[model samples]
Target: MADEPDPQLSVPVGMFEDIEDLKATNAALIAEVKALAAQVTALADGGGADPGEALGGDEAAAGGEPADEGEAEAEQYPPFILLLDSPAYDDELRALIEWVEGVLVPGYLAEPSADARWCHLWFEHPVAVARLHAAWLAWQELTDPASCGYTGPSVWHRDHLDPALRELRASTGPFAGCTKGEHQVGHRLPGLVPSAWTHGDD
Candidate 1:
């Protein structure tokens, strides 16, 4: 006898209906998300009226200052106070401070102009000059091994053992990446050498 055909073989219509329903639901969810995103962006760009005012909160304040005493009290630390007070010589003063950090401390010497402006270019801005003085003291404290020995003073030894002059010369070796026309700002001297240097052993 021939093999009988099997019966009850059928595609699940309910599964396809459920899948179609899920796709519709997913598309509706995506559209709703897009609309919510647009509303958030509109709120951010100040397109609509103030919601905070309607809600009766601090965000409605017109001025950008702190809303409460606690918020005002939080802003005690200001890094740019000196710069704002004395903006004129800020750049030169910053350069001078950086030079002292990179050159003078490594050379085991203090800036000659502890009180005067002969060494530093900008003496006019008192704030900048004062910051330079503070930087010098900080540099001294940082480079001294004893001052910060408890805080792992490896950096102190590194700077002290290798003098800045020697460090400059060392940068020209095969392993060193220095090239012609690549002058480092820290080592440049503005004035002419003294005449006493012409004598062999003064």
Candidate 2:
């Protein structure tokens, strides 16, 4: 060595070790970032769970499914449940079922037929949801204070409830051969040929 350089003056050996440690930390952080990005993309692309069906932050944070009230609250409420609507087997469709059982079934839908217990099993029918939604919408509007009490019920029955219930409770449709004794049976769907169960003397 023509001129001996001070060892301490040279880039310290400890610095090299620090750089290696930094590199590993950076690599790990980069990997974590990439993973987080991928998760974000998946959530965006798939249109994450239905808002009505999704659980609250607490359940999600704890990695648990909603139970009891959370599950009940999310079910068929907020209209977001429409996207995830399954039949009765799912049980997550509580709102629609509750409305049907509490309001439509009790107040409007005709009594269940002797052969077919449509009232008990209405949630099983896939088409029942759309019909329920229509009726529920009418109920919300007609029951609102702005609606004229005398005309609201009549309009709902004529414009929304009757037509929807006709298709829903039609004999040839899902709940076949079922009818409310007080109401007409064999009501035909739009495209289907009419049946001969007209209300007698009403």
Candidate 3:
């Protein structure tokens, strides 16, 4: 005979649903708490909007349809602020890399500036430069009192600078990807000796 369905083995669906709901509710509370902390910090530093406006408590809720539009349109955190404000996490970290590669790379660093120091040949080390520039930009933005982000000098170094530079400076990073095996590289510096053999010629 087929085994009867084990009634004791099946948990009530409501129990799982309740657990998930509690998890989500807790996460939201954590986010709100961090946001509140950032608001307090920004105000203490003398730059952000009123704490009442930042918190959006029940008493501070908007009055009309236009207010709904404003709420929908407003950025909860600006992109640069999102980089260093880690207690309130962002899922769009990959998007920061994409924007850096797509925009900041081509626009700013692809070609060395005319006034750039000879040691600052960014095109030869695009990945490292890109990461550094991105980290530097995050530092400038987050440390500003008006950024309304929970970032200090140490926090910027720890959060924004450390991880990116670590990845970018690794051997498998962009320069290596573009240089090893059969890859062709165009910009050797003036004093560098020529390679004995072309990468793919043999």
Worst 10 residues of 3 by lDDT: 112-121
After superposition on all CA atoms, what RMSD does each candidate show versus the true structure? 18.8, 18.1, 21.0
* Model 3 backbone overlap count: 0
As for lDDT, the candidate ahead, 2 or 3, is 2
lDDT of each residue in 32-127, candidate 3, tens digit only: 777778888998999988876676652223222344456776755344322333442233444555555675456544332222211223334534
Best by lDDT: 2
How accurate locally, in lDDT, is each candidate? 0.45, 0.59, 0.53
The pairs that clash in candidate 2 are: none
TM-score of each: 0.21, 0.40, 0.30
Q: Give the C-alpha miss distance for residue 62 in model 1, angstroms.
A: 22
Ranking by lDDT: 2, 3, 1
Deviation of model 1 at 133, angstroms: 7.8
Off by over 4 Å in 3: 1-61, 64-119, 123-130, 148-151, 177-202
Error (Å) of candidate 1 at residue 86 is 9.8
